[model samples]
Target: MKPIPLQRRPRGKKPLWREYAEALAVALVLALVIRTFVVQAFKIPSESMLETLLVGDHLLASKFAYGIKLPFTDTYLYKGDEPARGDIIIFRYPNDPSVDYIKRIIGVPGDVIEVRDKQLYRNGQPVRESYIRHTDPTGREPLRDNYAPVTVPPGKYFVMGDNRDNSLDSRFWGFVDKSAIKAKAWRIYWSWGGLDDIRWSRIGKKLL
Candidate 1:
């Protein structure tokens, strides 16, 4: 008599630990990419910008507004639109490459920017600033008239700290180039006046 064949046992599923590890690794890599090419977080380090942006104000930056950039190259794969005056911009300081400074674009390419007394004149016309707090105005930069007829060179930008008085800006150093810009600030996402304290009302504040 022939012996009956034995039934084969089924194989058990692989351990869940392997799957969890793989998922975690992928998540971390994705986060890094997003941080580099997409939105980035920035915190104001000084009060150079007062009412517009205060110290410790956290903000979101849109890198794609300009164009996409390679991970570690100075070359621009895609040339994007140029910046305009009155836009708040984030750019690498021309004199100091290691520093990233944020300021408003007061003058664009081929625009004449100058200040008389404590008032500002753009291209022979005055810029009406209603947001500034006139309490103890810092006054205009000294010898500002000497720098008049400043035609913004192509591919360059003029930046200024909102505080106006204490800021080291284009008036002091020089113009910021198109390549130096990192992103355009959009809004105040979160704020902390002190420890364990968060100001919720400041969230979603649109930047000018």
Candidate 2:
């Protein structure tokens, strides 16, 4: 007797729903990785940055500019170059780590910083800050107008906002530690001036 022949069953394709779910999961993972290690989107919430970064401006910050800090931790996987003076950076607020602040690097490690009559002096030389904006011309707050010189300790950065007169910065709080720095502000991706008013001109502008 001949052996009975067996018929093979056809294999069915994967469900469309499963494929879509897998694709969505992959996209979400990629976005999270990018946000944690590469670049992240942030929106300006106050007038602290003013003309440089207006309120309602959405910007992207390069997380790897200084180093790749482990997400939710201060430790870095690979330490990058030190932040340079005048480089705009995003860091955790020294006084309150829960909040984030963006400002220009005014003084780096070992640099002497002082504000004399609203003029900034670094390392005994006057800094030429063409980007600085003064909303109040006659305001003479002691710390705002004439700050006593202080040497920035190692691993700390002295930062200040472009809107000098209105900004509460290193002068008021303290220096930002290197480990607290998260990223560098790269460019303005989107901006809205007011209700239904998109700031087209400010879009794509690079932040210093």
Q: What lDDT score belongs to each candidate, Candidate 1 first?
A: 0.80, 0.91
Please give the lDDT score at residue 29 for candidate 2: 98
Give lDDT: candidate 2, residue 102: 94
Model 1 CA deviation exceeding 4 Å by range:
1-17, 73-80, 133-147
State, as a TM-score between 0 and 1, how close model 2 is to the true structure: 0.92
Tens digits of lDDT, candidate 2, 1-208: 9999998888898899999999999999999899889999999998887788899999999999888877777777978878999999999998889999999999999999999989999999999988999988887889988999999999999999999998999999999998888899999999997888999998999987
For every model shown, the clashing-pair count is: 0, 0
Q: Which ten residues in a row have the lowest lDDT in candidate 1?
A: 132-141
Clashing pairs in 2: none
Candidate 2 C-alpha error for residue 144, in Å: 1.2
* Residue-wise C-alpha lDDT for candidate 1, range 1-208, written one tens digit per residue: 9999998898887689988998999999998887877888999888767778877789998887788778778766666656877788888889988998999998988888887765678899988876543333644446432355577889899887776666778888889998899998888998877787777877889898
Q: Looking at candidate 2, what is the lDDT of residue 149? A: 98
